[model samples]
Target: MSAFLAPIHSWLFNKVLLFQDIEMDLRNKYLEIYGEEAREIIEETKNYGELIDRTKSIEELIDLSNIHGWLQNKIQNGESRVAVILSIFIDKYGSDALKTAEDIFYNNGIKQGQMAKEKENPQNAKDIFSTLNNYILEGMPCDRVQKLIQADEHIVRWINTSCVHRGNFERANADINLFYKLRFLYLKGFVSSANEEYKFFETNNEDDYIYNIEKA
Candidate 1:
C-alpha cells in the first residue's frame, strides 16, 4: 500500500472487524431472546457481515448502498417468520445496538482528528463534515449525505432523505424517539471530535440537518 493510503486501509479493515463484532453481539442478544428462530434469521443475515469483510477496496465499500434493499427483501420476502422475529429484536435492542456502533465510530473519529491536529494540519469544515458523514455510513447502511453549497461557507447543510436506520426503526416498530437520540449522539460526537464550535439542528422532517461549523 502507498504511504498515504496505509492508514485508510488499516482503518477500513478495522471497521470491517468492528462491524462483525457488533453483528455477533446482536446475534447473541437475539438468540438469548428468541432462541432458534433468531438463530435462523441471524444465519440468513450473515451475508451482511461477510460483504463488509470481503470488501477489498474503499470504492467497493462506498458502493455498498444496497444493504437496505437486501435487508428489506430478506425480512419481507425470504421468510414470513423472519419479519416478526427481526422486528422484535429491533424493537427491544435497536437503540442499544445502534449506540454501540455509534460509540465505535465516534471514538475512531476522535482519534483521527487528534492525529490530524498533532500533525499541525487541523481539519476544516469540509474535512470534518466528510469524516462525520463517512462515520455514519460506515456504522450503518445508508445513502450518502447530499451536501449543499450554501452562501455561507462556514456552515454545512446536508439532507438525508433516505435513512435506512429510520426505515429499520419504522419496520421494527421501534421508538422513533430513540432514533432521534441516536442522531443527537452522533452529531455531538462529531463536534467534540472535530473540536469545533458549531450549532446543529435537525429538521422536523427528521432526515435533514445543518451544521454551522465556525460559530461566531
Candidate 2:
C-alpha cells in the first residue's frame, strides 16, 4: 500500500506471475518444485493465452481462484509440523526460533533449488501471478494432489539441514505429512507465523465462506 512496500509487493506479484508463464526447462523446474496441483495446472494451460480463456467463464473463474488459495493452503499444510516444532522451540527456548530458522537455511547440504528460472524472465512472472490472482478469489483452484514421494526429497533435505545445524535430532525426524499445510505466501503475499494466536468467534457470510483477515 505504501510506496516503499509497493516495490517489494510488485516484485513478489511479478515473481508469482513467473509461476504462471512457466515453460521449457523453467516450467519443468516449477513442475518439480510445486509437484501435483501446479503440474496439473501447468499441463492444462501450457501458455498464457490458454489460461486467460480458461478463466473467462464465471464458473471456471472461481475454480481458477481456488488454485492459488488452495495452493497456499496446501503449502501451509506442508509446513504445519515444522511450524509446530518451531512453536515448541519458542516455548522452550523463547526467541531462539529466529536464530534457528536462519541457521537451518544458511548452511551446506541445504540445497538451493533453481529460483533463477523465473527471475530471469519477467513475462513468466506476469503469467504465474495472473493465474494465482484468478484462483485466489474463487473456489478450489487445483484439485491435483502431490504424492508424498514426489515432495520428499526437498523436504528431507531441509529437515536434515535444520537438524544438523540445531544439534537437535528431533528436527531431522519431524513429520512431513503435517508440514504441507504451510501456505505459499509468495502468491498470497502475507507471511503469518503459526505463533500468532488466533481466537475464534462465529460469523455468517451467508455464502458459507470465511474471508475477513481481522476479526473484532
Candidate 3:
C-alpha cells in the first residue's frame, strides 16, 4: 500500500506503469481493499479525478486511520513531496479553517532564513523568540509585545479546536508560514504602537504547548 501510494507523496502525486494500465493498476490495488466490483467500477470511470474523489471518500478503500496519523508526517520523511500535497489540500479546502499553517503553505512559504540573512541575523527565529521571551521576562515591554501580537488568520481557529489546523511545530514548512503571518504584527502595530524596540517575526508565541492549536 505504501509503495502504491508513494507517488502521491510526489508533487506529481501519482504514478502509473503505462497510460493504458494507469486505471487498471490503481484499481487492482483498490480491489485488494475494496473488492473486485468496486475496482471494476473505478477502472471504468471516465474521469480519473472523479474516481479519485470517490475512492478517497471510501473508508474501506483508503485506510484513513493510518493516513491521518501520517497526514502531516511527510516533513520528517518526504518533505518536498509532502509540502506539495499539503499545498494542494489547502488550496482546495482554504486555510481559514487550519489554525497554524498547513503543509501546503509551508511547501512554498516565506524565507525567514533569507530574511534573517538579509537582516544580518544568523538566528532569526531564535532571535524573534528570545525577544518575545524577554518581553515576558522583563514585563517592561507589554505594550511593545502587545503591538507585536498580530494574530494569525488561523489563530482563532486553532484555539476553537473544532477546526482542522497545522503550523510549524506541526511541520517545519508550516512553521515558516505561521512565522510569516506573525511577522506582520510588527508591520501592523510595532513601529506605530509605542516608543520601544522589538524585533519582528512571522509568528508569536501563543502561550500553549508547541503546535497546540488550542493556543495558536
What TM-score does candidate 3 get on C-alpha atoms? 0.18
Off by over 4 Å in 3: 1-101, 107-110, 123-207, 210-216
Q: Give the alpha carbon lDDT tens digit for every residue of 140-180 in model 3.
A: 11113222222342221111122122432244244435333
Q: What is the per-residue lDDT of model 2 for residues 147-184, given as tens digits with 9 covering 90 to 100?
A: 11212211110011111112111333433322211122
TM-score of each: 0.46, 0.23, 0.18
The TM-score leader among the candidates is 1
Off by over 4 Å in 1: 1-122, 138-145, 149-153, 168-177, 196-216
- Between prediction 1 and prediction 2, the one with superior lDDT is 1
How far in Å is the alpha carbon of 216 misplaced in model 3?
Answer: 23
Name the 10 consecutive residues with the lowest summed lDDT in model 1: 74-83
In terms of lDDT, the best-performing candidate is 1
The local lDDT score (0 to 100) that residue 108 gets in candidate 1 is 46
Given candidate 1, what's the lDDT at residue 124?
A: 55
Instruction: Write the residue-wise lDDT of candidate 1 on 1-216 in tens digits.
Output: 232334544454444443333344445666775678667666654432333434365444442454334333432322222223344555556765455545543454455445444543424555556555433332223233354544243666655444445444455444545545544554555555555554344554344554344442
